[model samples]
Target: MNFDYTLAFAKELDQADPLASLRKDFLFPKQNGEQFIYLCGNSLGLQPKAAREVLEQQMANWENLAVEGWFEGEDPWMFYHKELKSLMAPIVGASPLEVCPMNTLTVNLHLLMVSFYKPQPGRFKIIMEAGAFPSDQYAIESQVRFHGYDPKEAIIEVSPRAGEYTLHTEDIIAQIAEHGAEIALVLFGGVNYFTGQWFDMEAITKAGHAAGALVGFDLAHAAGNVPLKLHDWDIDFACWCSYKYQNAGPGGISGIFVHEKHFTDTSLNRFAGWWGYQEAQRFKMEKGFVPEAGADGWQVSCTQVMPMALYHASLKIFEKAGFMETLRIKSETLTAYLIFAVNQVNKELGFEQFKVITPTEAADRGAQVSIIAKDKGKEIFQQLVAHQVLGDWREPNVIRLSPVPLYNSFEDVFKTAELMLKISKEILI
Candidate 1:
């Protein structure tokens, strides 16, 4: 309850943290012999120290066993991804059989669409947010076009009311209700990347189901950033990339979840590959595709062991830190402190020089805070970077600062605010 911005207080909180020891697991970035205040985890997470060892093990297997690494090695390359399901399932609130790690985010999205988006006459539309990531927009548009439907007609995008930066839950629900009957699929980001607004997946899924549509989510920013209940929410399917909050390095392998009820739906269509073939009979080189029941049936190729190993190293840290509960507590306080500090700085500057675009309520948002500098957005952002306060710039004016609970400290948030104050003064003059 007590939010103090003192160095002694921050050190005390760090000492009391159960997950404090987990910080050592990562290789923090340094600048000019000093550690950089990394508030850019939303873009790319810091490297895990254990990641090197894990990847090295795979390198040794590839060296010593050669092609035999697929079957003869200690951890067979063919089944490397199977080891990750148990660790990832709980993170997304899914059954172990309902989840699998394979392919990339956009690739998996297209793959899932093949199975879930069955466009029937008169009811063949896809509903999504208007300001979705460009990749998602492209995927949805391409999918609609591939099905011989005009994207302009088949894609119904929901946008915020005038002069608003974030979408409201009520507005989203109303939009779904208005078009649900004609929509074949309801796909949306679990959290809007730019606004940092966490959508109500359960409510949206329920609305879609009530209107005879399938629901899916792209959880690139939400997967490890917040607690999810995908299975309990009865979400039909979902996909996510692990490079961001999952800390699995750049271009890491992605994951997907399919409800158990859909596992035996023989009518569901998919673009099958050998990897999805039944594991028991796969070696026999069967004539037809007999998919391994559940989400594993979606795998299109053999696992990429190096990225999988990196993911394993990070998942191990999540496991040791008690996953979401421990991290969520710290995330709430850290983000609140950052917002509070930023506001304090703005008041001292004699005018509203900066604004947080993220939701004010912690329950409605995640760890990242997107800020817009009123006068010199880009100039102020560059100054902050020059001061060694690392955040990311998005388009014309926004700067995203993510205070990750796993490694980012209260002091980092304080220092970033101080740097912003100094930068603003220089820019205004």
Candidate 2:
């Protein structure tokens, strides 16, 4: 896996990519009729070319069938999410029955917390990585408060060692061990949004259980970006959004996973709705809540037909691309090449202009490489944007560039680095 920071080398890789054809499936943003090199899939994915048509078909069903669309349309709005759950399960590694497409990411997190984040007596603390996506932090803080505990005292944050950018697995394991007796739940992002660190889920889950705690993850970045084994890892629960790597439309439908072990646990609590009522007797208007057999039981309200339609369209493309394992192969090499090319720019400048804080090891990261651009991070980012090289910038310094395997080419990676090198020479501090 040698890398050369050359346009010809990148084009050669593009020519050999088995997933190269997928680039045609998405419609990229344009600048003066030319396509932009979109590396912002970590923030928002490019739209699929057929997205409009997919929406229209669902729209047509509603137009033609009216209320009957619930049970009469080709996909039957009643159960449209079923096929999507099946397609998504293997991407994150779970049983189809354990996965369900429903509600927004944070909402699902709350719903799941209601059932899994039980705290009592002295064993009431929650352990999580520091600087998690803010929504997760809020969820944990709010949940801890709802149970009448002080957030500062009940929430234990496992921070990186001083001056380090990422958490080591050993440090994470040690923290769990040190607080095992008091931790009620161990929750984390499957991949940290800012640093792009993919945590060791299996070890975390085992450590949590050994300490008599439940475990779960918010897979907002990791779900479609890497190959996961949520069920195999014995994680108690998990959730993810479809917009990023799943390429569902903006604020796309979210999904959740509840392990089979929790399905019949009568003591667990849930915020239930009629949609969660067992399908066979749902319309009977029964009083007592009887949940559908699996993760679908967590649904809080009637499905939003359109977002699920948008997500289903993207899921179909995932099927054509031969799933996440195939995508992971390209993801690893694509990101490694991004790292090499970015470093090569620094090499030519005779200084390290940008420092990649994301883990360089393939297993520790997914598609993203987070970089801190010395003092010009934001300036470098704006220049990259002006040149139609679209990536993401954080508040002060970091830029996140993700070469999505489904659409981004090796040429995209090279040209971005070439532009970065060019911008460095042209821009004055």
Candidate 3:
């Protein structure tokens, strides 16, 4: 794909984009009356324009129907999640029955672990990537400790080879096989949050199953940003937050996926609650819990109507743009263009000022491009933000910029690079 470092070229690409009109659906942030070229969807998505109306409607339901809101209204609170299930399933490539909108990411992870992370006498170890999100590290450590095993001894972290920032699929597979006999579970992020490397989920799932372990993922950065096939890939279970690429607002509702195969596994454990009771007999208030027949059974509390309303507004945007397949096509090209633009910046500056750490291969990454700016990295990042080319800066010297296909344009990418090059020249000279 030939690319030119010109604003006209970027506008030409934008004009040719099929999903261009979809950008109008979101509300971008403004700083001092200047609309930002938001490129931080990997951290938090921009708000959907419809979010307020949807939230108001739910608030009205609570006001008008009061207690009756549970069973009344166009979308009954009791079954609101069903509508979300239908919309969410296509994004992750799973049956509606296999996915459920429920608690936030780590909470769902903990609940799913109770069912899937069974530590047998000999098989008591958990294998995960070395630098997973901090919450995951805490959860896995506590889970191992709860089972009376030393975390240092029971947790196996697959690390990148020396001097490398990402894991190779073969290395990950070999580690799983090496620890196959004693491994109880294999958990990894769908995309590493720091480097934005999309893991080979299908290969990892196959390896985990062959190694006699249950596999799962923390998809905080992957869901809606990348195409996934959780069901077809034979993933036992997975969980994700919606605030990132899904544009579900800050701390939006998270969801879980449980393969239909696990629905009938009576040995599985769950921290049962009233909402999880079989719907038909829920009014009877039976003393014993008969879990709902599908992923809904995993629900511990009743519907979070307000958060779900916001999430529903965003899912509608996804449905309007079709599914992940279409979005992924644009994502690949958009991210590639960012990489190319950054390279162009280096060429113009006569040095590798911005070193991209994220994989350039489309299949191995999603929307994020993490770069390390030499010498004045933090200053460059601050300048980007000040100039409204909004991206996030991490500790030391990393900047994570994600060009989300839903709202970002090629012009945004071009201007970002243009500004970066100018900033570099000013700072270095």
Instruction: Please give the CA lDDT of all the candidate structures.
Output: 0.89, 0.92, 0.94
**Model 2's TM-score against the true structure:** 0.99
Of the candidates shown, which would achieve the greatest lDDT relative to the real structure? 3
lDDT-based ranking, best first? Answer: 3, 2, 1
Q: Against the hidden reference, what TM-scores do the models get?
A: 0.98, 0.99, 0.99
Please give, for residues 27-120, the per-residue lDDT of candidate 2 as tens digits: 9999877779999998888798778988999889989998999999678999888888899898889989999999999999999999999998
Q: List RMSD in Å for every model shown.
A: 1.2, 0.9, 0.7
Report the lDDT tens digits of candidate 3 across residue range 292-409.
9999999999999999999999999999999899999999999999999999999999889889999988999999999988778999899989999899998889999999999999
Model 2 residue 187 distance off true place after TM-score fit, in angstroms: 0.4
Write the candidate numbers in order of decreasing TM-score.
3, 2, 1
In model 2, where do residues sit more than 4 Å from their true spots?
none
List, residue by residue over 174-251, the lDDT tens digit for candidate 1.
Answer: 888998778999999998999898898898999899888999999999999998989999999999999998899999
Prediction 1 TM-score vs. true: 0.98
Candidate 1 regions exceeding 4 Å error are none
